[model samples]
Target: MSKSYDAARDVFAGWEVDTEAALTALSQIPISMHCWQGDDVVGFEKKTGSSGGGIQATGNHPGRARTPEELRADLEFAYSKIPGKHRLNLHAFYMDTDESPDRDEIEYRHFIPWVDWAKEQGLGLDFNPTFFAHAKADDNLTLSHPDAGIRDFWIEHGKRSREIAARMGEALGSAAVNNIWVPDGYKDIPVDRMAARQRLEASLDTMCAEKHDKAHMLDAVESKLFGIGVEACTVGSHEFYLGYAIKRGTLLCLDMGHFHPTENIADKLSSVALSVDELLLHVSRPMRWDSDHVILQDDSILQMAQELVFTGLLDRTHIGLDFFDATISRTAAWVIGSRNMQKALLRALLLPQDRLKEVEENLDWTTRLMLTEEARDLPFAAVWEEFCERNEVPAGLGLIDDLDAYQASVAGRG
Candidate 1:
């Protein structure tokens, strides 16, 4: 070990923290990187539709991956820069086939390419049912649409997506998390909110009627406060999904950008953990609004990691990133975001949680506050650099030249 890391290790030992153990734990945690970032949520379906949901990638960045092959190549490059093995979060619309299948007509065969690629890369795969960016969703309604036909179509799509996810998990020998997030809401005031929610509940029940082995696939439901067009009301609000997850025995997804701007998702982790057996976190940076900016090692992320580690919720939580900044090199965005999350986790792992808890229990607020502040000045950067070296990935400014060269190579991509 370098002299700097050794000194840092000694400093951590003073607080009864094991630097080596923290590094080992950090290496084991896999951050499932979202594939939509590579192509701005534009999947490889033969008939590509517009991104009509609140979701929007607001940049004309060149070199965005246009094909499945190109997207995979981009993802490969991203994985190379990030340390530790990770998983991929794919959308139902990103089918890698020549056949033109509508959302409801999708089958597991259409996603075989993704399964094969994941196996080859030794990565886990997660899935999402695409409920936006299609003709049926143009009115900002889907599963809860007043029209029974539209609701049935989306319900079928959700059912097929769950089946595909189960197969993917079986193939990879990991329980794939099939997270459902629909864009059903109203742009203005709604007359009967009860009816919409009741419809949504019924649709979800029918879609998830076919149960799969827990070892093969796990169901998760995501909620949103509001979106661009659906400003007045979001069908799947936090309260709606939280209660549903508890009652239905499914994981609840908490996207950082999906909540109110002032809300701290870190605080919600422990509260919801009491009810949900497992949680899916979509870590992202949001500026005043759900801007989907690249995440940094900011206070919010650090607090989130600390909560997970301190509450012993790390094992039950699936960490995934959700952001798409098309203005810069998408690969860099992935690398930086993933690494920042790992960095946050590492910092959390290095905390002397036991001592902190003891002090708080004894009502020693002064020591607790002081120790927390002191930790911020520790040699975290030194230990992080060593981690990057051990993982055979670039650290600090070394990534700049690497990403620059990659951008130049892909500059010709139309």
Candidate 2:
């Protein structure tokens, strides 16, 4: 260990927390870095006017990835800065294809390049079916569309996406999480909410009927409160997905930005874990709206990580990032958000869980509160610096200078 790290480790040792043990636990948890961050969610598909599904990436930062090669290069640079191995989260529209196959007809051959590249990097892949930014989705509907042909088109897309995810898992020797999130809703109050939900239920049943190996592909359904256009009636609300996940035995994806602003998503982990076998967390920071801001080591983030550790749900939760800020260097955004998550996890792992539990069980609320507050001031940074050194990544604000050098050398704007 470096001299500074050794000194910090000794400080943490005084608190009765093993800094090395915390580093080991934090390294084992994988945070799926989103591919969209590199390209501003503008995929390789040729047929796109703009996102009609309330998804808009703000700012036009220079050096945004324009092609598959550039995006992969940016991702590689990002992975090198973040400590430990992590998975890549991809959307269906990002397929490396020149034929420009429509969503319904997209084949696995289009993503072979992605799988090969991931294998070389020792990363697994998670996938999502793109249900927006298409001509068929112009009505703000997809799987629950009133038109039969439009619904069938998206259903077919879902089916093909599952097959691709399964193949990805088999190739990488890891279970690929395939998530379904659609922008199907109305701008005004609908006459019949049940009708729309029933159609969606039927569509999901048909799409999930052909089961892949559980060891290869894990299925998840996502929900949202509202979005840009469809702010009145979201078809796939939290209640809808929660019931469906319990009944169908699928993972329920709880996006941090997809709920009421006042709600704490961290509190929902254990309640949902009781019924659902697994969870897929779309970790993002929301401002007043569903603006995908870069994550920070804020209180909400720390609470979420602590709950994961305190409840022993780390093994059952699939943690993935879903933030896109086009105002800054895309590579730096990746490194910052990813490292913040790791820091939060380290903070969680360093908590004195046994001591806190003892106080809480004995109804010693004062001591419990005091101990928790004191744990926050522990030498987490020291442990984190040592972690970066061990993983061969730059520590702390050191990444800022490295990112600037990269932009000046290789990622300059035209």
Candidate 3:
């Protein structure tokens, strides 16, 4: 099999693509797997009414993980089927607790078990402050709420979440990316948009004023244009977060589904990278609006990987998956989305980037276009199969059978 990969390597070598270097690069890039996928975003937090805020996870899949043990089991299984080491993204609401603590009061103790488990699995952890799906967010506000008390509570939660993330990083010896995203916006026209934006800025400043060691945690802020309910405007627009990140020296999160339908977020990467120190990518598939659909091997994803590789920004970019499709197998969703991301990256790495750059730089537009089209017909499938073989996972459609067996094993349990 190594010789087989070597033979495929020869094909890549002809194009000045180092297959070994590409494989090594792909292996080093870590994709943060969202924890909500396993349980349909229904965290362990105690809540009375239906999920609030702008977020929603449709469908009622049968095999959804009902407990922490079950979710971790599903995550373990999903991670096993994918290549490369990865990180798990955890929302603060996904705490493993016997007694519920208010979001603001949550401490490092609630997530110690998760840190232990992640260490055992050789996986790093990323943290997010769950600004949605709570009574505090019933009015479609959190850090940006006009009410000072509500704003204060969420600010405390943000601080606590960051602390917990830092502790996890220190314990696991890998810096955890602590991300903040709030569903703060209006459904219709609002005369006081400035007030909300100002409140959000103040809250974020208060939360991020105290700095933690960068070796342990990196703080990032995410923005969205619109959502299911917030159709009119989103407080944390890309512009707002971009300015905030640059000024505050924080990482900016670029969620694939967070921009306008016609906008390609890949274009923003270079622009943002020029100012921001690092980036956190929430790789997702959006149907029309910000619908969190499972990712596929689509054009946008390919362009995203290419942009990252072409700009040579892979090391500074933190890749993470963000989607929940309750209509399909949760574990399979994890495997499919993560693997597709890896596939996109591998293809990007296998590209003759230097050759393409040379033609474009010299204004050889026709040759550049021809090369772009021709590169698609290269032996990408062969190289991908070799990656799967090297990773010891099922090659090609062989994963479907493995998924079927897993389904059978968990069929009767739920």
Best by lDDT: 1
Per residue, candidate 3 scores C-alpha lDDT tens digits across 1-414 of 667676878888899999888888889999999999998888887653546566678897668888888889999999999988899999998999887798988999998889989989999999998888888898888899989999999999999999999999999999999999999888998899898999999999999888999999999999998876788888999999999999999999999998888899889899899998899999999997678899999999999999999998998999999999988888999999999999999999999999999999999999999989988877777777887888888866689998878867776665
Candidate 3 residue runs with Cα over 4 Å from true position: 2-4, 48-50
Tens digits of per-residue lDDT for model 1 on 1-414?
789898999999998999999999999999999999998887887874655576789786778999999999999999999989999999999999999999999999999999999999999999999998898888888999999999999999999999999999999999999999998889899989999999999999999999999999999999999988889999899999999999999999999999888999999999999999999999999996678999999999999999999999999999999999999888889999999999999999999999999999999999999999988898899889889889899887788899989988887897
Candidate 1 runs further than 4 Å off? 48-51
Please provide TM-scores, in order, for all candidate models, with all chains considered together. Answer: 0.98, 0.97, 0.98
Error at 75, model 1, angstroms: 0.7
CA-only RMSD, every prediction: 1.0, 1.3, 1.2
Residue 322 of model 3 has an lDDT of: 93
lDDT of 3 at 98: 83
lDDT for 402 in candidate 3 is 89
Q: How many clashing pairs does model 1 include?
A: 0
Q: What is the Cα-based TM-score of model 3?
A: 0.98
1 against 2, candidate with superior TM-score: 1
Computed on alpha carbons, the lDDT of every model, listed in order, comes to 0.93, 0.90, 0.90
* Model 2 lDDT on a 0 to 1 scale: 0.90
Clashes of each: 0, 0, 0
Off by over 4 Å in 2: 49-51, 410-414
